[model samples]
Target: MAIKLLSQFLVILVVLVSLFVNNLVLASEQYKDPIVIGMSAAFTGASKNLGLELYHGSMAYINKINQSGGINGHPLVIKAYDDGYNPLPAIENTVNLVEEDEVTVLFDYVGDPTVTKILPLLKKYEAKNIMLFFPFTGAQSMRQVPYNQYVVNLRASYREETAGLVDHLLGIGHKRIAVFYQIDAYGRSGWDGVRKALEKYGLDIVAETTYRRGTEYNSSFNPQVQILQEADPDAIISIGNYQACAGFIRDARDANWDIPIANVSLVGSESLLKLLLETGRKTQRDYTQNLINSEILPSYEDLSLPAVKEYRNAINSYRGKSPITKENYTESGYNYVSFEGFLNAKLMVEILKRWTDFSDQDQLHEIVDHLNDFDLGIGVSLQFKHPEHQGLHQVYYTTVSNNKFVPLKDWRKWSK
Candidate 1:
């Protein structure tokens, strides 16, 4: 009877121990699942090209990291959703990513309207490890928020790029300048930048114009062109995306207005180049010659740089069957996505390495807050602080010549 009782007690003990072990295994599995990074982009519709480039670049980096054993032995997974460059869908996608998917970070989508709708949700959820990288929109509202705790802007701010363009024009002795900007926050930011930069030279804009997005302003450009021509500005600065800028350029040229034309970094893409070329308008040639493109990454065509070579090798190795074609291989857009995503992933990995256990959210936030002036490689560096969330503050200038973008100057730190 004593032996039988001992045997029953041992069995009960084994069962309890087994249950506890099983629960621990389950918890570990839940934690080990790929650290989810959510992406909001325009996968469909007009801005699909931008989305495709961003997705490919980000996925390429993710694949490279996973092949090398991932972030602290846990794979990084990207959960992407198409917002079609619309605000409502973007907001809905943000809610789903945070509440349902429980993503660790959020990749940016294009357009100010869409991002504006999602900002409050990010704050409301207190998504601890969440950060937005390489946002397509450069609105001041996105970058200048009072307590943007979890946001990290990758691109040079609209104001910075605009000032750079204006300074370059001023250096060339272009005194009279005309401005054409989109009628939105993004456009307004560039307008303000131009205004401030010109103030330094004691010069003011000779003529200024605005256009609404998704509207046909090609015909209406006649009066605006006449006004700019009458003003006889030595240069014209465009602060909008491809469509409106293209129309403005074409109309200006058709009206026999020949002057140096400069545009924001948003206009520095293959789509914009293709649109200009496809129109076969004389303005395309003039615009291409005079257009000054600004970039936030090293030029892919410059093989002298180690980072560019690595990026080239990555694209060649990973994209085997569907290789990036010569016609579509500018690397500006791809470099932006990869550079931002890789840096974010690297920062996360660094944080993980510093922690022996990943159970504390406060520690994670503190580490991220303390991350400042960390160099990633090939001139890409990040600086994050408690008050300032804009991680990157550098921009590179380049120009498209002979169907290739050539670097004009070395990387320069941007000033407010």
Candidate 2:
């Protein structure tokens, strides 16, 4: 009888211990696990500056929120992989993020080719009810249907950006536009926007030149630069990344081709300005007057608006001061990409909070369907109605001044 009782007590104690261990694991899985976001962008190679700016900006906001206690009891974490702005590596990073890391969302990928190549994966996941949110490129794919069903864009389209530039230049009576572009889908997209914009004015590009994609700014731009110099259009519209575009401008100036240079927002305004300043041929005034870079948001330094003020505070406060993670960022301070990244985080969190249920992708889609006419502070609003994937229709024009991007206040008044 004594042996029987002792055996019985041991069995009961074992059962209780197993139950406790299981409960502890369940609790850990539930409470300690954070909400993961994965990013695949060019963190190295020629496009490093662009990638870091966007990454830093998005992470800055995310870090701020998590420090304050996170979203609905879950912390926000970002995992990033450097794809060198290439497609093959992007595919690998994305697959791992989806299947292994199991991130809750994907955000702010730079480069049109990267986004274009990844759309099929985005669709594959969408079939499983997963969505890719707020990619960085304003490519037409993100703005078109079926694909747009899976993507939720936060900015104006490349077409809209280019049109704004053409209209403003036309307003000032500068035609005879020439174009220089990278030889890729990304470059082609910008070229097309320019073509369409010029078509509206019954005009055509005076000269068009191309450079092989993925080369650095220091690459031989002399051939293209010489071509443009010979044509000598009133203004040259450069549709490429900052380094290459900056190189073209630098080379053009070297050739004494002093006509105005125009660039779409993807040109990396801060990087381009930095290159010009470092080269020492152009002063702040020289750049602010002769060179123009169109923007989706006003100059980062323009803190007059309520949203701009908030952006300033967030990026300045959080920029590069945090513990390091899978991704690295520049402490070089706030600019267009980082500010845009901060805005991306804000927009994501806002839409996410309204999600009917976190796990229901269908519900998220429903929310996106009605996400139009949304207010995003700074007195700016968004319209995301169906058949129109672009949330923001307006683009801001900027020029470098005082070593920074200064809003052309006149352009805004005229842009309207």
Candidate 3:
């Protein structure tokens, strides 16, 4: 009897121990490791607002997705570094993100110079399956051969934007177009776009001026304004940032040379408008007269679109909970840059869902290359057809009205 009791006790003990070990293994499998995405953007210096807003918008959706059990039970994480909108730091940040952080993907990089500089690194790190997704610039380098396989663009190119602007201006009988551009790859891209569009009509840029990167709003743009004024062009397209563009607008208005100025989506329109409004209020002058800004994303105020409504709701919920530092934070309310960032995150998640195995990075290129007609609630289907990695080609134009950017319904407002 004693021997039989001991045997029964040992059997129970073994069964209990087996159950405990099995539970531990199941728990390990249940709680998977996080999927990390890396970013290198301008969190400091002149383009700080754009960087911070983009981060905030991406996090808004990412945080929600994680809360609801992230993509395939793997939480999404972002490891970001501030490049200060410079190329060298961007390269360093890219290396750190890939080598040390070991991020699963790279997303939402800012500025043309920084992105163009970092493109070569993707080929170098091809063994790591590194891909640059949704960089902020519309420069052609990312859309063309060599880098096209490694990069994907979520916004319209500068060529599309400039062509639309030139076509509209010409439709309204404004042909003599001048260009104010930053002397860099980005500026040259826009300059090239305008030149090509005008070439189709046998027209040419009547005047052109260049500004160095990081030119501040407090800096004098009187020289640039003088050059544009002397050209006597009917309209001017500016390929530069908010501070420099706003400063030029202020000076140009102060000089009373308001012959319709247009800017591409690269300029942070909200920030530019705010700066001009503040200056105008102080100086008792209207600096926003005859101003046009081309946008890659639809207007945020459009409530009818599912994407806009979702974006507003997401931003409202994510505000005050963003991880941005105090110095980098801004009251970015319904901004285009942030909206684009939000869409970037949304589409990434969608793609991951369709991918059979997210852990297999080697298969990413094949998946993305084959992805087609995926909708992000943006009223447009996104397709990543190979040899054409650019997802969106639609460009919208806006002008200042009642202290806000409204759609350009009538081109006659700026007719010469």
Candidate 4:
């Protein structure tokens, strides 16, 4: 009788232990699932420079976080599609990301035309309500009120960029400024910013010309170049991507027109410099000396700040190493886009860390929409109150010196 009772007790104990082990395995499997993020940007075309930089920069942060046991034990993963900086593919990519890929969030879209194209799709799938965070473009189309509240912007708007560049030019007494823009919403947005800034000073653009948006990065800007050169403005502001903008600069320079050329942030500064050095006739310094571009973030080289130091260290550590997207790692490593991408990812991790239910769209929005006066580690603050989701309101100006982008000290609007 005693042996039979002991056997029954042992059987009960075995069943309980089995249940505990099975639950542990199930829990582990649950935690193994990753957070999926979707992205669409120019990866193979004229705009690959910034597009790839943005990918690596943001991915560095995400990869680090995953290595450190990701937000709430779920790794962050990106599902990206290349739009080649065009509108049609961007629409398809956007829809597929939200529907087929079923990503929890969208991020780091590259161009104005792309983002503008995706807006209606987001509305069509409004029920999905997947939030788009920190697009690379500073175009105002998605940042305006009555704009898709689902969209979030990490960088300063083109309006702010053009305003700062205009302010700098005006302060330095360069009044006759010509606008060289791509014939698209992106270019027109910069044009609008310049116009608004000039209005304050009781002035307007001296001349304006445009190239097609999808022009080959290294293609001819001769028609636009000849027209702008004929205007003979004291200065010209190039508001296209690096490829076309560089083409415009090179062609204009070849025509013996050497006006001080300034560009908006979307031009991809370092890439622009590379083009000038590789394909242009003059010394790199000669072309870059008179060139200026607006920067949305402080220089990544300013390692005195803890955030900048962290960014540099992160990029250094992750350089040429990403399991997800190996192509992002370039021999020519960091730039403004990378720095901003890191910032975007840092903010993204912070946003995701605060919430756990990735399955619930409403849960994500709660954390995002209510981000009030949150102090970003860079000693600046970000907020996402309703009808306005643009995070950074400040802008900085930079110019190339010795093959690097250094601060244009007098042109920065934000205090250090």
Give the winner by lDDT.
Answer: 3
lDDT tens per residue, model 2, 56-114: 78877888888876776578877778888888888888889888998878877778878
* TM-scores, all models, native as reference: 0.78, 0.87, 0.93, 0.89
Over 85-168, each residue of candidate 4 has an lDDT whose tens digit, in order, gives 899999999889988999988988988988988887777776876778989988887887555576888788888899888887
Q: Which ten residues in a row have the lowest lDDT in candidate 4?
A: 320-329
Candidate 3, poorest ten consecutive residues by summed lDDT: 320-329
Which ranges in model 3 have alpha carbons more than 4 Å from their true place? 1-30, 320-330, 358-362
Q: What is the C-alpha RMSD of each candidate to the true structure, in Å?
A: 6.5, 4.9, 2.3, 3.7
Q: Rank the candidates by lDDT, best first.
A: 3, 4, 2, 1
Q: Which candidate is the best by TM-score?
A: 3
Per-residue CA lDDT of candidate 1, range 1-416, in tens?
99999999999999999999999987785557677778787766555556566656656656787888767677877778888767788989888887899877677567776787777776776645455654776667666664366566656677778788788777767878888887766677788888988999999988888877544323356766776787778888887766667677777766666576777766535556666666655434545555556666666666776656666566556552112232343433444444444444455556555655454656755766666645555566566654545666676676557754567653221111
lDDT of each: 0.66, 0.78, 0.87, 0.81
Error of 4 at 349 (Å): 1.5
Clashing pairs in 2: none
- Candidate 3 matches the true fold with a TM-score of 0.93
**How many clashing residue pairs, candidate 3?**
0
Question: Which structure is stronger by lDDT: 2 or 3?
Answer: 3
Overall local distance difference test of candidate 3: 0.87
For candidate 3, list the clashing residue pairs, or say none: none
* Candidate 1 TM-score, C-alpha based: 0.78
Clashing pairs in 4: none
